[model samples]
Target chain A: GLAAPAIAQENPKISWRLTSSFPKSLDTIYGGAEDIAKHLEAATDGNFTIQPFAAGEIVPGLQAVDAVTANTVEMAHTCSYYFWGKDPTYAIGTAIPFGLNGRLQNSWFYQGNGNTLMNEFYATQGIYGLPAGNTGAQMGGWFRKEINTVDDLKGLKMRIAGMAGKIVEKLGVIPQQIAGGDIYPALEKGAIDAAEFVGPYDDQKLGFEKVAKYYYYPGWWEGGPVVHAFINLEKWNSLPKHYQAALTDACAFANTNMMARYDMKNPQALKQLVANGAELRPFSQEILEACYAAALSVYEEISASNATFKKIYDDQLAFKKDAYLWMQLSEYTFDTFMMIQQRAGKL
Target chain B: GLAAPAIAQENPKISWRLTSSFPKSLDTIYGGAEDIAKHLEAATDGNFTIQPFAAGEIVPGLQAVDAVTANTVEMAHTCSYYFWGKDPTYAIGTAIPFGLNGRLQNSWFYQGNGNTLMNEFYATQGIYGLPAGNTGAQMGGWFRKEINTVDDLKGLKMRIAGMAGKIVEKLGVIPQQIAGGDIYPALEKGAIDAAEFVGPYDDQKLGFEKVAKYYYYPGWWEGGPVVHAFINLEKWNSLPKHYQAALTDACAFANTNMMARYDMKNPQALKQLVANGAELRPFSQEILEACYAAALSVYEEISASNATFKKIYDDQLAFKKDAYLWMQLSEYTFDTFMMIQQRAGKL
Candidate 1:
């Protein structure tokens, strides 16, 4: 039993700054940090305060991870996959091709080996991590033309990141690694034939429907994409365990809030997108099957070279196998029946 | 902009007690309160500690609601549906037949009107509620015989709870409300032919598979049963705002943990049960269809009698329609495709 030590009444006020990978234009994603700050301050009697800065305010969005690692900033909220360029393992922290969904991702993190594994990896980066938010499953991307077969993906220039880009390269697609702020202009200028940002809510705000009429279903590359807070490892440990718990609890609250906000906002934004002439289409079976094959090969190749990656990836793979099997019999069965009934106007 | 006033340095020591409906033997369910207490103590710098007691230790499991209302204890963790006998609206706080899954339940409670509506109703009971834990979707129950049609349910005696009993009654099934400790014995003795508790993890612990060979899945009545912490309203109001926030954040942490723990545990528990000769089965389509129709009518009748039930039910029903629509197009599609590919050994 871990008995509590006696309470010591003395307290010290502290202030910290958080750098976010998101620009203010995407309120739901960026506001996750603000949610953490607000709750932390409220929880601590205002004894602690954290101010959040948008991308480029303190450092470029992609560089927030480095900023936190360098101890130049106290904390940051960003998509971990953004740093996969430094190490492929980072992508698994956020999302991977045909990876866990939002629900499964949380199960992995809080319940399985994910929390400890990711934290250990972050420790090597001189950072400590807490999940702040997830975008659920994202739309594949917005394309100028509908994709009908695997051939439609060949030679297609698309703006994407992380392992998804690497796997798509095998499909003969040219992968363009564009930053968040520049993706819109890149797509509009036809520099990239397609781009995958988040789902309907964020995509609508970026006006993707105006430039591309074909909006695809399921971003296989980034289902349940987690956005997390990266804290300087030394700084995190320096805080009292009490403060650590407060920060972690606040992060959990923010995690649930982000997904809920997106679920609420996306349905309406999607309707508006359709009304504004966006075409909703599921990825053709041929394309999905091809990508699934490419993804498996890519995973195997990467795991061969990276021991750390192999360890974490293998753990998730087993968890995913069992989880999907159970979900198929339970969640998927009910959902399928209900959906069919709904379509028939019986529900 | 709600700016922090100023950091106050003084704090007071506090101690509280939490009674849980779960027994200590069921670590996954019972551990949810421990998680909350652990986080709360750490967040409050050990200035606050909450000691947890299992059911029957303080008050009998089902009496937790009344105990909290009467301030027999400062707080209690239990299934809200356990109190549906007090008010049918209580069942909605936890789950309803064909209601939201865990993911959607969180969205409804935190992001939709559920929080406000549930809190408002709790106010009348002199209580304050916070969602502290959730057991994702549950298995229907363990039955001694397979159910092939609605006729199979005719005159069947089963131990179930919430409004599920009322709906089952419509199909000529006899529903029995059995206590946690007595359910296994009753089932073993053929006093009850079927029993639904939680998922594989807890059910296996109770040795249900030894007595019942047929294990059915997708408990429609409990897609995502949320177990909450009920605090005496007067005690909650008396806490400093800082402490209140600490408690709320801690509850959020536990909410994520409960589902994750169950997800991580149930897969193995289920596999073990199956190896032990427990046959896995899905409810027949005829039976599900009949239950669906009965559930709808039961809901209507209850709402017609209880305005409180109507208000909350209407809000959730609207939310469910929109949520399901979006999920069908996005989440369900991806899951269905991915699951099929995985089963074909392609994913």
Candidate 2:
């Protein structure tokens, strides 16, 4: 901000509105829109400014995409998976069970033709999906009791969102779909045995660690979940090239900034959670393996029946294979080895 | 490119020149500047354009920062660590031995105070450093013969660059500082026993694989080296606000795009290298541990005598420790588990 240029814009003034899936309380997610607006305004010297409305202030969060498509709003920031009701292909737009991580997802989206393919799908719905933010990776959730095996999942009333809800149901777990604002109380009052939210940063704010002493990680459900800035194609097309560039480029900025902020903030939050009597845990290998198998069948069934899902699933599966190989050799190997050394007190 | 904005800009024309640290032959490294120039020109509808000059045209790649500082060129694209001879603090600006990986490095630079700190340092030299591109995790290097033990390093000659050259030297290896163009022949003619020039993309172009069959990985030295676009502070301050915004935002765009491009391209390149007789190898744990120790001590020695290096080194070390903890818990754990299941033919 200190280095901002001083020249004023000669273009026409413009104002727009952005509806967000997240409430104002979760700054990290909701702030994505605010950041974009800041950059746009700064670049244009206040010639353009966007006002962001939290979920339900205009249209409900889940209906954000529809609102944009209907021209009810100029733009919206929300996870694409929230619209799986429209089509299961939406799930892969955000995150998929046992799918790509943050870096791999970005690699595919920005470089591996994912942006083109997904946007092709979104175009049919009258929307353009600009990847605006990511939540690096989410924690599995806070559980009141530890889950030791696959059998521990039976009849468990757990609050999960999007596609993860459907996948977990196959393991005899009763999926409880609860709104973000309502999830904490449900878990606190024992209405739900467990709950999954963004991560330690947001989960700590929601006070999940207070009631659920057992904190588990590697959110198989939402590995590197991304939020899309859904813009109406008509509205987007009407904007000036420079303005469009500003918005598009700012979305990418928000995307990188969101992950960076989370990466910096989460470690501190995790430490606090552990210090607050919350026990850190990883899902047992048996449980993870079972869920992995269950997830595959669930995906297979959906892809077999849904043409849209089938198309994306096919593309993603192929891409995921290459990503897995490359990341295993580069990213995973580096982190794994470093972790061993760090844990071994060498670093 | 398919989704380019349709509107054209109405801005006045302006032009600038950029000196790059990489030669035209190494597209991956040199392309960072080109990508930035392309985005800026596109955003401004050709009203603003930056002409990128290959190394040795205006000045050698290593002197790029000096060219920018001296206003010999309007801008330059180069890795900051290439100037380690000027000051050890330069290493943290790009990459350090056992420093951050791609995502974590970006997180530190953009999200943390790294941008402000590094820019503050650059300002002292009358320049502005823009975070433009990253190469992700680079390969360890190509060697004519396999290295299995610490004893193999004794009296061995390797063409390594940056701070890594010094760290390896501490382990009794005679470091051979050769130009990129000279590295291949140096190894081929036995002037150097081993050589490294980047990962598969450029290394393949340099014909390292054909001459040296052993390709080692994790790079250990340059985990996620980032390229900085350096602008003369006076020239930058004189640009129009929107033009400044275009350049700054485009740099971020190029940063994301470069890494994404490398991530997508490296997998295929590695595969092809292997098919063409490159025997992939991981540095043995013994060598890695030894280099890591040597790196830490080298850093300590530098930080002990250099105030600037001490400041950034302390900050980076503290940040890396927490990053290690957080990554181990989330990023590492997820990738490791998924890779296991993936390699086991599960999912």
Candidate 3:
């Protein structure tokens, strides 16, 4: 009687729909959206469920944010920077040129006030965000020839993302914003001289090695890029407390899973890219110096015009300072030794 | 032309000390290690070089795995799984028993793993580990907990870890294996019910967790757990291959850096426990029967003893497969409806 009585009192079922900015081709990033849905359903014992849609399946790829804002979809998985055209502050939610790398960004979000600050910014845009995934620190871009000096950047056409494009623009280079699926065709046809994506793993999958022979180091633009789950504010609030907690927990899991998958897959891909004649080159000193200078100028310009951006930026920069200091003593010292050995073949 | 040749031949006086398992901690796992060290040193010019060290450290944590492993005395930061014994795994890693709640575990590791794992697993033995971080899964210690009637496990003192001791063993408990630091106190106090450390994370931290928990699981033993770094391995091999590749790329960036740390940390620690609380627990019909007949036998034990653990587990149980299938339909369905509704709450 006790078992039957308890069984009869079941929780009500709830369902959800999620749209993703990535195509299934980028499994890890796109896969994060899918994972969130599954965990939500399972955790709630099927009482709650979510459905996912890929970029362009239900709406245009670039329109994810607008759609969520307009209530066209209940939720969307996307990088906040894509909507920077609406507000530059959104860029901080995703990445910034030479900003915090993935781990630090995560610290900023969960431990520091990053999540809270970014969410406040998102609120102004009519959405809320959960850090769903990250691409760690990224590579600069794939180039057709080695970048030997600052002059190499002038007149070059590059497919970069968000605010980095603005910074690069100041350096006399032309910047283009294109989706992941379109990068290869453009590179192959010479429509764009360069393109930047998450590190070796995803870049290889997109077949950048075939079209670009010189892969440069350090994606200064997106030191640590975060992908977000943009949820409709009103809807998010309506969910039962348990469902909300479940979604948050699932997103955390998805975020970590994405990083691990990338770590495992990138090494082999990098080795393969090199074997395919992709020459890995460091960014020229002059060019790096120029970009660093330009990045500072852009930061000043944004700070001058955007109050919200300045608030988050100021705090983030401060945290980065402390994190860097601590790392210098531990992470930095240890890593330096290893790189030298790797180059020397003693490793 | 003459000026160019001199500049080219200058070959910047660059050097670094990296502590890692892989050459670099890029690709997310190791990439982070490589990127930070390389970026920092480069950013500051050759004045700052980082040397990396791999898993065995300069030698090996089992050999001498910590900062001592690489000899980069400036500092060594990493997980606690690499040094299982000298103490119990619980001291260094956090996968033991019901353990601290997940969030609590994070605090414990950052705040607790530092002292506990180090003092119990490393310090007393002349090595050291830090709570550089976590990965987070961790199911209830795989249990042979008998439940057909609940009385079957009486006096079944099993190896368990952390707090899970009191909960499960409560049903007629006999917990044991507290971690290196905690173990002496607990075993001496006879407070344990049963215990578990981690598959590898806390395992090397030591199998003492295994002493009483009887080490049962679906790993189910560890759904997902944090790993650690154990330093010593001849003070991590007498340093200076960039302090042994910055201590082998900071233990290959804590090897996963957390996972690899756990991997390296678990072996030697487990080896040390041959005579201690090392009995494996078998799920009794009463316990298995009460849990799930399908649950008990369906746990992929066939894969437990062979190459299948390596191969089939990822494809079949690693979250990707089921998550993929379920998200495809359910998440898609729910998100579509929710997105269309403008009033949903945002994250």
Candidate 4:
């Protein structure tokens, strides 16, 4: 009884495969990929479905971007920094040591030159990236012993790899790359002295508290790490304009959702870890200052060699310098006031 | 040549109208409504379109929700607290004095029980609410003179209303209810000693810096205040499943986009405000403490009378208590360190 519109009548049915860099067990990060798939299906009435495969199902977690680039998969959900060894510019896509926090990173990407600059680098690599998720500010990993000074970080073999590894190495830290599943055992068996994963919710799942007593605050290295949705450039170009818009909106939704879930879940997970005798510790000023200096040096070294990294990093630093000024004035003051009330049991 | 699917073939063409409570000049907040319309139109290939009307175009700013309820429009982009006079529960849907920040509020809504609890209250008012925008933490306000202590607040005439008015009234301040367009003239003419607006980005547009030299921060009452996409419950229920999903995702995208734009824009605006002889000031600890105590007393009084307000507020406070604990440990420490570097000009 109705005449079908040209757009609807010509709508093409398509299905694609997505590989996630995380296992289904860590639902917060991996679930972001699933959310994109779910929203696309519901928005298009199951016309555009994406089947998700966990790490190792199609390729190893660290190899997700490689799969996307090779066209082995149409898309990948991963953290860009995992392939930093190939190019330091990859690290800026996710995070950098002493880089922008989650909110600031999102601001830089969407409002500043982040999307354009980062995508320029990605396009060269035959990929297109969209920020799909974030893990707020992570912790400084679980330590078998308290890290009191710069001396404590010396010779500490930690499970950290990436731009953070390079920065820490300057502070006498021996960085080790360990798989997600192997972190707990490595810490327990003394094969590794400490490990840093995502925040409390995911870290608790990894059983880090069972082996390490001192849980540190402020993972200065990772800060606000972004997880990205990477799509093959050729495949991305072939998508209809409507599908592109739908996926963009869906990824943005997932980006916000992942952070919300972490914020909601981290509190309880942290409380549980504390009850299990996980000693919470703040990295002392001596250590923080030293690492901050070291981080700057590492940035200088990379910027000298990599022009692409330098361009994006320079833009991020400029934005960050001003962002923190405004942040410290408003949200900082408000939060500090509320925190005092909470400590006083007045809230 | 193609067999049309049942869903695609039955997709009905729809056009809806949205009224915003913000003026066209305040693009950050008002633009959020425009983004939703833009995304919806592009995603649905013009099958679904939403026309947005600025404040006073279709109805008065404060009457947006009413217009939606009366079916004058299908939806509205407005703050819930504007209708707090109708029911105190409305305030919780947007923000409250000393409540959750934007990130925490989003966490509560999407991951915690916020959406269900808030919608329950909205449903009672014949409305359905979705978080459409956030203006991170806001500046406290612009003041003609510095407020260095609680005593300085006594007998002060300020343009504030609703819950904050009640709390500040307990501190011997006379709260004035002035319209947006009237605020500039009031501050300039010494008719009001102080006024508060969104933040630096939107506040600069109001030209408060020219008259009120002392700008204070941590707008405690509106910390992370939310702007909602409110729909008539009857109209909302009639939407097709796919349309509902599209709207929901579209709103989330706008929510993130609005905050990103504000975060990116506020820094430059703040610098300009400072360059214009705007003296930045902080509310002293003594003043914050007194206000905190007065705010609690106000909440208690309202809780004694308003069950709906108490139900939603109690849940929020519980979430806020845990949220700050984790937030202070992670982002707080990180931001504090960065602020120190910025102050030292090391950045």
Among these predicted structures, which one has the highest DockQ? 4
Per-candidate TM-score against the hidden true structure: 0.96, 0.95, 0.54, 0.98
Q: Give the best candidate by lDDT.
A: 4
Strongest candidate by TM-score? 4
Docking class of 2: acceptable
Q: What value of lDDT does candidate 2 attain over all alpha carbons?
A: 0.84
Q: What are the TM values for chain B, all candidates? A: 0.95, 0.93, 0.35, 0.97
Local accuracy of candidate 3 as per-residue lDDT tens digits, A105-181: 67678757888999888887888899887775567779977778888788999998677888888888899878777
lDDT of 3 by residue, B69-159 (tens): 4455333334343343433333225343212222223323332223443344344445544333444333224233322356756776656
Can you write out model 4's per-residue Cα lDDT over B1-347, one digit (the tens) per residue? Answer: 34346545446789999999989999999999999999988777678899999999999999999999999999999999999999988999888989998889899999888999999999988999999999999898999999998889999999998888989999999999998889999999999999988789988988999999899988999888899999999999998877888888889989998999999999999999999889899888898889989988988999999998899889988899899888988788888888899888988
Residue pairs in clash, model 1:
none
Give the clashing pairs for model 2: none
- Shift of residue B327 alpha carbon in model 4, Å: 0.8
Error of 1 at B187 (Å): 2.9
Off by over 4 Å in 1: A1-10, A181-189, B1-10, B345-347
Off by over 4 Å in 3: A1-10, A340-347, B1-83, B86-347
How much lDDT does each candidate structure score?
0.88, 0.84, 0.55, 0.90
- Compose the digit string of candidate 1's lDDT tens values, residues A1-347: 11112222234577999999989989999989999999999998888889999999999988999999998899999988888889899988898889998988999999899989999999999999998999898989889888899888899999977789999999998999887668778878888899998898898888888888899988888778889999999999998777888999999999988998888888888889999999989998888889989999999999999999999999999899888777776677677667666677766
* Prediction RMSDs, each to the true structure: 3.6, 4.7, 24.6, 1.8
Ranking by lDDT: 4, 1, 2, 3
- DockQ for every model comes to 0.48, 0.42, 0.02, 0.72
